[model samples]
Target: MSNFLPTLQQNSSNNFQGDENNLQKTIKPQRGFKWNSKQPQKQQHPAISSLNTPTHNNSSNSSNKDIIDFNYTPSHQLPYLNNRNFNNNSNVPKLAQVSSHKDLKKLVETTLNSDSVLEQAIKLPKGENINEWFAVHTVDFYNHINMLYGCVTEFCSYDTCPKMIATNEYEYLWNINGVPKSVSAPDYVKYLMQWCQKIFDNEKIFPTDSNVPFPSNFEKNYIKPMLKRLFRVYAHIYCHHFNEIYEMNLQVLLNTSFRHFCCFTKYFKLLSNDDYGPLLELVNELS
Candidate 1:
């Protein structure tokens, strides 16, 4: 029984050894591998690394291109060409200016006189010198001159000649006929205006010296004297009597005063009318 026990023990040991061998075969490790072994994955090409890296060409290219375009061009330069030729040194032509119609008329009148037709038409009657006829017919036959004496008496106390204001008054009222007390004022106003027209016509003769330019002072000194005479007549007519006719005439006279107040109030253009025509215009403006 002891021998049998020994043999059984030996068989049990062999069985254990075979079981160990089977376990080794069933759980064997893969061949040719180590914990640190890899082919390094055939290192991917640098081109592939470059593609993954952040690059300005693709990431910021549109914005960078916009900046370059903004900074590259100058605004004022001629579009495609690099150089420009500016001609700042040349002189520009100037346009001529035109004179107004009224100014043109005055310019002509200042230098010229009426042609022959006016002179023949305005000649004095046979056997009458011009000045004598003008004085006798136009001055109310010295009645205006006589009134000048009264004007002197009434207003001559002031430093300046009463003739200044007084003559203007006298000329405005001279033609009213009948005794001064009874004379109607409208008739007086008309008389004065007509008298002024006559004096204006008499004084404005084309200067005897045709070659000489028309004097600038002719209207102021000569034409103004006539208007002032009329103004004096205006004053006297108003002063002596107050009436409805006088009031109406006074309003008319005042309304037209500006026409007279402006220097000559005449149409002074030459070659258009007789020199006397401007004097008549002066009377119209004043009266």
Candidate 2:
């Protein structure tokens, strides 16, 4: 019985050692087991091996390098990131290369002189919905004026432009409630921008839904006043700030925008003859 017990113990010990060896083989530590570390290190999974391996593709290497060295610098001059210049080899539009008055004029003429555009313009608001037509044109004019104003805002300062009146006029005063007062050009521009912004922001007045009834006398009261103010802005720019416009090389854009506005207003009989008195010759020239 004592000899049988010894044999049984030896057999049990051999089985336990075999089990331990199988477990070690299954685990297969990436690095051999370390005695110094208190905790057993986890072996890296096979999936992670690809991530550890270096890539040889040139494009991938350049992209990785760019990612590693990426940094952002804030600019105070402009609000948005600059767009990359179009490649000379690429088939970019000629308008994309516009930097001079001649280039701008060519682009403007190419766009406005198109038979399709003129035909479309002539047939605007084909249906009898004047409110919708007015709303559409109002938004269009607002955007155009906003862009023109933005182009020269940096240069249009109180120091440079003391009065709102043109060089030829004695005084350009805005009257309200039987009170006539002259304001600085910058202040006048700010007021015009605010007025337009208010109209644009009011969805109730200029609802996107066609079914919504436009506010009563919106065209007579709101639109007329808006157009009058816009004309004054145009007049002021033409008379006092032509040099600034020229310097910015935005003459073609300004001219085209004004011509379109004049055509729209004339087609609808929105503006009286007197409203266009100041810019009559200039309008004729542009047309």
Candidate 3:
């Protein structure tokens, strides 16, 4: 596992910057704005309807447009831990004992291959309450970003990443609660993390139990926008900071985590085509 880890990491780093010019050409600068205040009349897309696996009949009460059809299976296969000289019955190491990157890597390899672990990781509750699922994944993605960016904080600064946009030109703006602000990349990411943290920390909106109702317009107003902004962080990392990630020898981890995230969001249609278009090349290669 250790021997293959370095090789996989190296391969991911080598291909991480594939066809930058092509990516730049395809990327349309995202606009800064809030969602429409009024909900659009409910319209159903066959593709969306086919994918939905709702646990409740909230569709009769809420706008069908707001409900995502999450019934479709993911087309892409996630990367798996290579099993060698492994027994299924072997006891897996506890997370608290993982004290180093090497230990963490081993833990990941072991856990990912375990059927019990994979089932838990991939399973989502059947319901109209997408907030629970969204909240869980949101925290998961934030942890990934924290690890990936935290590794190279010294290199991630205003002088290095002057603007939040991946391209050198100022084509994109950071929109916070409907207001656009142009700032350094580090600052933009900082605010983005803060916003996500605030949402995750709030118990009223993201309750621990399944019985609680999410605030009205929560999915349309907050969850969707949060996902869009999160994709920007991914864009910035893949476009600008991949080399730094390579230097830190964390490419494989980043690649695997990012691929999982892409597949998860894609399954739910959480990201728009324009939002993920820039990174599609990399995403395809990783898949």
Candidate 4:
């Protein structure tokens, strides 16, 4: 395992509150948001009937969409040799859109597809701005996990997953306004993705102009929170949707994206040891 895989400290009680026991299946019939009823159903946990399709309409307009509508096509799936530097995802800033950021993205993409992940994880191109490196990867990971969840939305319904727990041991309670509340898996993930997208969209937080420098607190304030929450989404997918992903033949995609995420976050130290706790075993395995 990489040196970064050391077991992390648990979250302080006040910061995150949850009973560290197995997720208890409630007897109440799943009563909230349901996916498309017409879609095929899958075997599910007791008391949670498998439900319908995604809640949001799949439309062309990508505005105020609870889950961002933008889609990401991984470079590996493309004719990478012919199109290595042609990233068209507008949601992520090409801090190098008119310059060298495209090259950086291609370099990172190559590293993701390369065998020596640990060695390449810490590399920053000579004379590259570390903030720009973090910015691009941050948005890319968001697009990736968001797209992956969209794939499993049919399975990850409010009724199926009543509470946002990776397992019985690690439950994620979202702090709505101020209070920590247990919400449905889809809703919690929706809120989480939207929040991260909002941050990523803010020019003040992530400037697109080359002359402007990112704020000093960018790493501590923005990168840390975005990635820590992103990891939770990854944890949920691994815990709840791995079988579905494997059946879909997207397991390699998920695992590769996750490993790339681990590489960037661990190398940059954006997330602390405690933040990796939920998926520590997977981190070790994937490492």
Candidate 5:
């Protein structure tokens, strides 16, 4: 393995800049009216914050969706990337990798309770360096979404879901290199995570050595774009698999995780109004 001791500044900078430009362009303009919600936060699950998610009582969230017994395999995952062996998450940064060992199997087990999730999201720890703080939480949020989505992989198949959609209105298409591709939801999500994984694994982008400062454009160029895409994963899961999430009694944990994600993104202003379009209402209603 090559140590990312010194960044080839010109090359690395140009590469990410090119990627940023490509990411700025969407496959098609997302159709929606943008408005800040002044709606009162509705009551949430006892263990989570008030969110604009469908309650279990909602008729659309049937407890008995046709669930298949298939394990999802990402057909397009990078060859170097293999199945997670939970015991060794060397690929993940040190801070993000901590404390997760206590419960990897219990997907519903959340690290934060309702009262603390939002409060914790916005407060940078007193001793923490901001970029380093972002580095850790970025990895944390990624893992949270990753585990949450893993729960519904079998249900969100290419045949079952042709497009990566949220709210039945916003359909997300993947950008391959510089070209946009209208791929299946599973494929689109897989491609998106791969993009994030690549960034995290690259020390220049997310430094494994704390001594090596984060790249100059790390937050603006990498973190925001990465988190923006991660939000889509949440949107897709909430829109398409909330029923399954509800059935498994994971809705509270899912809601809490998503709330934490939203609060963090909102605090940092990492995303624009356009970026949150799919989940805008919920975001606006976040208490």
Candidate 6:
């Protein structure tokens, strides 16, 4: 045990208490050592100086080591860019398109007005070919049919419009080009409503104080036809106009002034009366 203790002491002295003569050897105190006051941070060392440079080797050791340089850009521009134009006289694309349409219309009109084109277009075909009168008559017939259909349809479309009379049933008037003629009740109602809307939407029945009164002649010519048409067709009549049922019923067939038709009862008292003799007489007189 004594031999082992001397050997252990010799090893401790060599490690913890180095020879004072060797400059490279260090002697560290046992557990109760004080802090070293002579040591300084190596700020002037070449390794540290390299680390402070902005070179690649210095950046390699930093937290942002992998960050690469790039020129970033945004996706969209602000609305003001729409107003930016280099040429002052350059019109917008939409305006140019509209101008092109106007130019085309003028060119077509000019061409049609030329002597050869006008003469050729006006010339009639030979041997039962297309005649001027035939074209006119065909157009007139279709126009009349369309107008009549529109009038009736628009009037009958109103929720309050009266049911059609027995004569107004969807029956064949005539076969056209082998096609069966048919006009549904709903079709008639739709046309009637459209016609009525056109006429009454902006029409003033009676003038007001602020406005100049419409001329009496205008009323007699224009307004009278409209009023007659409306009275003849619109189904419901209230107190004021029920007395004129004869005039209204007869006017339905004679007048073409109404754009659309609708009717209303004029007076409850007259409507309830069992004696419709006066009304019948008025209708007969008109007819």
- Every model's TM-score: 0.21, 0.58, 0.59, 0.63, 0.64, 0.19
Measured by C-alpha RMSD in angstroms, how accurate is candidate 5? 15.2
Write one digit per residue (lDDT tens) for candidate 3, span 121-169: 5556443245655655665666566556665566667897777764443
Residue 92, model 3, lDDT: 28
Against the true structure, candidate 1 has what lDDT?
Answer: 0.25
Query: Which of candidates 5 and 6 is the stronger one according to TM-score?
Result: 5
Candidate 2 lDDT at 272 equals 71
Backbone collision count in every prediction?
15, 0, 8, 6, 0, 23
Tell me the alpha-carbon RMSD of every candidate: 62.1, 35.2, 20.7, 14.3, 15.2, 51.7
Candidate 4 residue-wise lDDT, 69-139, digit = tens: 22223322222222223334443333222224344335445545575754454456556678766766676
Question: Model 2: residues >4 Å from true position, as ranges?
Answer: 1-107, 114-116, 175-178
Cα lDDT listed for each candidate: 0.25, 0.48, 0.49, 0.56, 0.55, 0.24
Kindly list the per-residue Cα lDDT of model 6 for residues 180-243, writing each as its tens digit. 2333334333333333233222223222211333344433333333332223222222111121
**By lDDT, who's the top model here?**
4
**What is the full ranking by TM-score, best candidate first?**
5, 4, 3, 2, 1, 6
After TM-score superposition, what is the CA distance of residue 250 in candidate 1 from its true location, in Å?
A: 6.7
lDDT of 1 at 230: 42
In angstroms, how far off is 31's CA in candidate 3? 34
Compose the digit string of candidate 1's lDDT tens values, residues 134-153: 32222231233223222223
lDDT of 6: 0.24
- Residue pairs whose backbone atoms clash in candidate 2: none
Candidate 3 residue spans exceeding 4 A from truth: 1-96, 99-102, 110-120, 125-129, 176-178
The order of the candidates by lDDT, greatest first, is 4, 5, 3, 2, 1, 6
- Evaluated at residue 210, the lDDT of candidate 1 is 21
